[model samples]
Each structure stands twice: as structure tokens, then as C-alpha cells.
Target: YLNSFVDNIDEMKEKERYLMEELKNQENNFLGIKSICSNKVDRVEEISRLKIEMNRLGIFLKNNQGLNDFSIDDIQNKIKEIEEYYVSDEEINNLQNKINEFKSKIAYPIIEGVFGILEENFSIIDKKYEEAIYSSMGSRSKFLVVKNEKIGNELLSSNNSSISIIPLNKIKPKIVPGDILRNVRQLGGIPITELINFDEEVSKAMEFVFNGYFLFENKENARKACYDYKVIGVTLDGTLYDPKGTLCGGKIICKNIIFRRKDLLELEQSFKEKKENKRIYEKEKYNLNELKSKICNLREIKKAKNDIQIIENSIKFLNKLIESKVDYSSELSSLRQNIVKKIREKEEFLRRKNVLETEIFELKNKIKSKKEDEKNILKKILQLEGFRRQSEIKISKKSIGEREEESLELKRKHLLQNILKSKSKISKLRELLKEFKSGKNENSKSHLPVQFQEISDVLDDFKLSSNIFNVDLKIFDVKKEDELKKELFSVRKEIEMSKNIKK
Candidate 1:
């Protein structure tokens, strides 16, 4: 999210730069027109300025085509109407505005420069290639082209999520094989890109989008171009055909979106007509001082006065557009900065949140392990008690004669007394015996405590004696009350020893 915000800021900076340059250009244009006239107007200089502006306008119209519907008669009639001076002041003012409006429509949006505009606005398409251009370029014709991937990414990162940009640095022209081009042309098709005119700077972008397709004169030819040549193309009627048996086309709403060839020719024709108009006025120029000395015709005076009004109104209009872009640019900057700070703060918060979650997970795992350890320890102690009880019963069952049994028991007690007294020794005894019985490892038997080892040796001797005692038990006399008391005392001693081991 923060990366996205940083991208937005970079885009805002570009927009700001574009707007500032636009502001400078508009201001210069406003001042340049103002400079053409002074307190005492020079008619020749005014005509010269008009010629220069017209030439500049002509260059601009090449990239940004003029309206084809606007007839040359409108301008010619405006000029002829001006001679009468009988036309309303309002009408003349509107006519002059009509002349400037061509630029007015195209300039302000670019001056604002909040979004990237396409280098080719389908203005490159002439009438013959409209369908092919549409099929080849499609919605991508509306895609904004930028200087590099960084600029494209930055612009896309802004709040306007719906738009896309093509970075010139990232795209390459699609290469069509020479044989394919020759074959296509032989089939009465021309590569659509050939008909469209675009700048060399954007040639890569243009061809990358458009060069793959061809324009055929009709649907039948277009179908053949698709089937035989295995290439895509469209008919002049706007039907699209692809080699994959795809056929899809309909009229795309192209008013203001596309410019036909005639639109461009008409724009050139306007400049030519205006040039002729300027030439007719050019022959009438008199010496500057001499013209100033004698009063000029009322019609010529009206024309100069009218031109001044138009320029002044244009300056006013430009000032408004300048303020609008400046205001939007400032707001956009502040918005981007705030978003940057916000994203940074949120990212820091996310980092801390992750750390806390990790700690919580580790703590939970530790608690669960300790619980399992506790249950295992309790199970081991219960098992040890059961083994002790079973061993006592086995030894008692082998006892027959009191004298021999008492002697054996005393000897075993003396040896085990010190071992049982040491709780750590008892623990080691259990550990070693468990390891040894399970065949855990070679080291278990060798590592037993010395006292526990002596007890083990004595138990082995008792096991050997028990076998011999079983044979003698049938012949031995059984002592009753006195034996019971001795047995109870021995059990108490064993209980006390077990308690010491527990500690």
C-alpha cells in the first residue's frame, strides 16, 4: 500500500511539471498576441503576426485534427461579412472565438495534465483504414502512452484505477515477416499501420499495437486475408475476421475519438484559405507613419478593433484555465503527501502486529509441550510403583524357612539401605534399568550409579536363591504369630526406604 502511495506522489510531480510548462506556454501566447498591437497599431505587423499564428496553428492541427464538418465558407464568409461592419459586434466576436476554439478545445485538457494522454488518439487513422485500425488497436487506442515503465506504473497507482498506460521503454514494435507482408499486399491488403501517420518518437508504441493487422478493401478479401494468410484484418465496413474463425465487429462510437483523413485535409485547406485571405490583406499595407498620419478606413479600423477584443477575451479565458489547473495540481500534491504519510504509519503498525503474533504462537506451543511432559512423568511413576509391588510378592512367595529367609532379607536390606536413601541414585537406577530393558543404547548399563549397581548384583543373587528355596519349602516348618510381627516390621522398613527415594 505504501509503495502504491509513493507511486502516486511521483505521478503527481509529473502532472505538476506538465501543468507548469503549459501555464508558461499559454502565458507566452497571451503576451505574444498582446505585443502584436500597441497604442498606435502597425497594420503590417498585425498581418505578420496573424500569418505566424496561422502557420503555428497549421502544425498543431497535424497531430490534433480539426473538425471536418466545419466548412471553409464559415471563415470566408466571416471575412467578407467583416467588410460590411453591418454584422453585430456580438457576431464578429463569436466568429473570432470560433477561430480560437479549435485550439481552445485541445489545449486546456493537456494543460491540466492530470492523466496521461495517448500519443496517437486514432487521429492517425484515415477513412479507408478506420475498421482495420479499430480492430487492430481496439480499446488500446485509448491507452495512454508514457516515457517509461516507471511513469506508466506511477500514473496507474493514482486514485483513478480505471485507466492504463503503455510505457515506450517497455514496448517493442511487432515484427512482421517480409514474405507475409508481400503475401498480404498481393492479396489486396495493406498493413493498417502504413496508412496511419504517427511521430517517430511514438513509432514503437504505434507499431507495437497496430502493425500485426492488415486492411482489406472488403469483407470477402478480409476473410481470405485471415484464412489464407493466417493473419487478422478488417473490412472498410468494420467487419473483423481472424484466422481462428473469429468474426466480431460493430460500429464503435468514434466521434471526437477518431479523425478521418479528410478531417486533416480540411484543416490544411483552412490554413490555405486563411493564407490567401492574409495575402489579399497584405497588398493593402501602407507606410506605418503615413498610415498613422491619415485616418484608415472605418472597416479596417473595425477589423483591428475587433481583433484586439478577441485577443483580450482569449487572455481572460486562458487565465481561468491556468487557475483551474494550478488549483487542482496543488490539491493533488497535498493529497499525495498525506497518503504517503498514512501508508508509512500503517506499514509500521503491520510490522509490530506480526511480531506480537509470532510471540503468541511460540508461547502456545511451549505450554502444550510442557503439558505432554507432565502426563508422561505421572505415567512413569505409576509404572514404577506397580513394578515394586510385583517384586515384593515374588520374593515373599519363595520364602519358606524363617531363619534362612530372615538372614537373606537382612543382607539385602543392608546393601539397598544406602542406595534407597539417595533419591538421585534411585532416579538413575530407574533410568538405567528402563534404558537397559529397552535396549536403548550400549552406554545405559555402563553409566549406572555405583550404589545402584551393588543393589542390582544383590537382586540377581536373590533370584538364584529363590529357585533353591522352592525345593526346600515343602519340608520347612511354618512359624505363625512371631513370623507375622517380623514380616510387618520388614514391610515398614521397606515403606520408609521408599519414602526416602521419593524425596
Candidate 2:
């Protein structure tokens, strides 16, 4: 009986030990529950703060002055109009201003030791043969056509370093061979010296310069006269054929007053384009600022929504822990699962945000690249203009001749054609860029609720379709109108030149 009692006491001791262990485990579980509940409370506070921030950002975005003032369609239409408005008149006015400014800076040299200056300026009698005389004279046209030899000698001895005086008195006319002359006449060619209407005093100078040269109607006749008949020949288009089986022909870029005008016009056009591009960049930057604010608000709303979800999940877990019997292992497993799930959710949000931010960064980089390209193009245009102006200024300071004017008019036409082509390309690029921006804006709208996204997409599609239709119609109308206007302008210019020639 005593042994049995001892066993019972030992059993009670074992039971006490078991009870104490269970009590310690319950205390540990209580501490864990407290920690989890505290964490849930902290998450609730964080969620509330995030909600407040989101609401604030939303309100700010909704009330944004610039963004709220205009509808998207209105803004887009204004941008399109700004892009399409023609600035050619501005270019022309600026060019005229620059030409006037350059002319104001020119200073002519004064000869201190020269004798009496005799200026015997001769005009072209026949406009049809003006090109032939100008081509035959070549660089000699820059020289002053004077009749007195002593005046030329005195001018050459003067202190003036800029004078290029040519006296007709000292010139000896060259006599062409009879056989060559006969061959040239047989080829429907006229001697260049015979085409000019000049004073008798200057006849020797003209003959000395172009007595052996013959002008033909075309290159084929000129080549026949030179290669087959063995005589020097020139064509109206400035092709030169020598008697020694040599031919020189191509477009001539003469350094004269007429070319200077063309260069100035091109520079003005480039400047206007650069200015327009700068304005576009400025406007885009302003729009980007508004977009950035809107994106910020969207990101905040997304973060707030995620925070609310995490907090709600944490509260639910805490509630489950409070209502159930304290099972430490099971509660730990549940808490761990919740933590892992929350971590995955946060990671997903971060990844989405990163992707959005990356897209924004890429868009910014593209804009920067375009700006750099535009800057480079503007720099190249300015450099070319500077070089052209310097070269033009270095040439002789004389009035533009009829042939030079004609050449300049042709060059201007060619430049206009090139400008038209460039403008077309620029317009196409602008349209593409506008479409890309519109698409990007549409993509941004996808982050909103599904119902809102659908509505926005429908509106965007309608606007896009309308824009496309209008653009097609406008392009067709503009093309026809521009062609007619160009033809009329050309005809008017020809008539004006004809009247001037008659005068």
C-alpha cells in the first residue's frame, strides 16, 4: 500500500510538470498573438495613411488647372494645327531682312591715286543671247569695262587693292580661222562676240575674249561643231566643247549676288523650322508635366489599394487567431502563409510599377533622342548657311547679271522642291509621333477600371477614325490647291520677268 501511494505522488508530480509546460507554451502563444495583432494594427494605420494620400492625389489630379481646362480632343486638335500651319511667309520676310542687313554692312573701297574713272556700263541688247555672252566672258565679267587705258593703268597703280580694271583700248581682237568659221556657221552656230551689243570702243575687248567661241542651240549641235568640224562650241545650258576633243559640262554654282539671295532664303526657312520645333518641344514638355502628375496619382491609388488588401488580410488573420483555441504551430503556419502571400502581392505591385516606370523612361529617352536629332539638323543647317554666306561675301561686289539671275531662279526652284520634300517627310514624322503619343495615352488609360477603360477606348477610337478621315480629305484638298497655286505663281513670275525684259 505505501508503494502504491508513492507511485501516485510521482504521477501527480509528472502531471504538475506537464501542466507547467503547457502553461509556458500558452504564454509563448499569447506573446506571438500579441505581436501579430500589433502588426495588424500597424498595417491598418499604414493603409489609412495610404488611402488619405491616394485621395489627396486624386483630388489634385482632377483639379489640375492645365489638364482640366481643355478636353483631350481640343488639345490634340490645337497641336495638329500648330504643326500644320505654314510659315513660308515668315521665312521670306526674314530672308529679306537678312539681305538688307548684310547690304547695310558693305563698304566699297576708294582709290586715292587713280585718274578720272570712266564707267561705260553696257546692257544686254538681246535677252535671248545674254547667256552666251555671260558664259563666254567667264571670270572676265568681274572686271570693270573701261575704254581708257591710262585710267586702267592709274587704277592699277592706286592704293585700292579691290579694283579689277579692264581697259578696252589695250585689247587686240583674235581672228578666227576661215575654215573654222565656215564650219561653225554650217552647224547653225553664231560667234559669241557677234551676239553682244556694245560700244565700238569695247568691241576689241569683246572680240579678244570670245572671237573664236561659237554658241549653238544645244549640246548635240555644239558637240558636232567641236568634235566633227573642229571648232570651239558652247551651248545655251553652259556646256563647253573645246576643239581638242575635251568637253566640260554640268550645273554651275556661281558665287554671285543671285546665289546669295537663294542662300539667305534657305537659311531663313531653316531658322523658321528650328523655331517651330523648339516651340513644339516646349509644348510637349508642358504636357508631359501634366501626364507625370496624373501618373503619380495613379501609382498612389494602386499602392493604396494594395495596402488596403494587405491590411484587410492581416486583420482577418488576427481575428482567426483570437477566435480559435491557441494552437501555436497552426497559427504560425497561417501567419507564415499570409506573410508569403503578402510578399508576393507586394512584389507583383512593385514589378508592375517598375514596368510602368520603365515605359515612361523609354518614352522620355525617345523624346530626348528626337530633340538631339533636331538640334543636330539645325546645327548642320546653320553651318551650311554660314559657309554659303561667307563664300558669297568673298565674291565680287557687283550687280547680278541676267544669266546669273536665271541660274539663281533655277536654283531657287530646285531648293523649293527639296524644301517641299523635306516638309512632307517632317509632316509624316509628326503624324507618326502624334499617333504614338495617342497610343501611349491610351495604354495609360488601361490602368483604370475596366468600365472606364472601355469607355475611354471607344472615345479614343472614334476620335482616331475621325482624325484619319479628316486628314485624308485635307491632304487631297491641300495637294490640289497647292498645285494650282504653284502653277499660277510660276506663270505670274514668268509674265513679270517678260515685262521687265521689255522695259
TM-score of each: 0.31, 0.27
Residue 184 deviation, candidate 2, in Å?
A: 1.0
Error of 1 at 124 (Å): 4.9
For all candidates, the clash counts are: 0, 0
**Which candidate leads in lDDT?**
2
Error of 2 at 378 (Å): 88
Runs in model 1 deviating more than 4 A are 1-126, 159-161, 256-503
The ten-residue window of minimal lDDT in model 2 covers 112-121
Determine which window of 10 residues in candidate 1 has minimal summed lDDT: 107-116
lDDT of 1 by residue, 399-426 (tens): 6456676866665454334323433434
Query: Model 2, 274-349: lDDT tens per residue?
Result: 6676566566766655555555555555565576565565556556655556666676776566555555554554
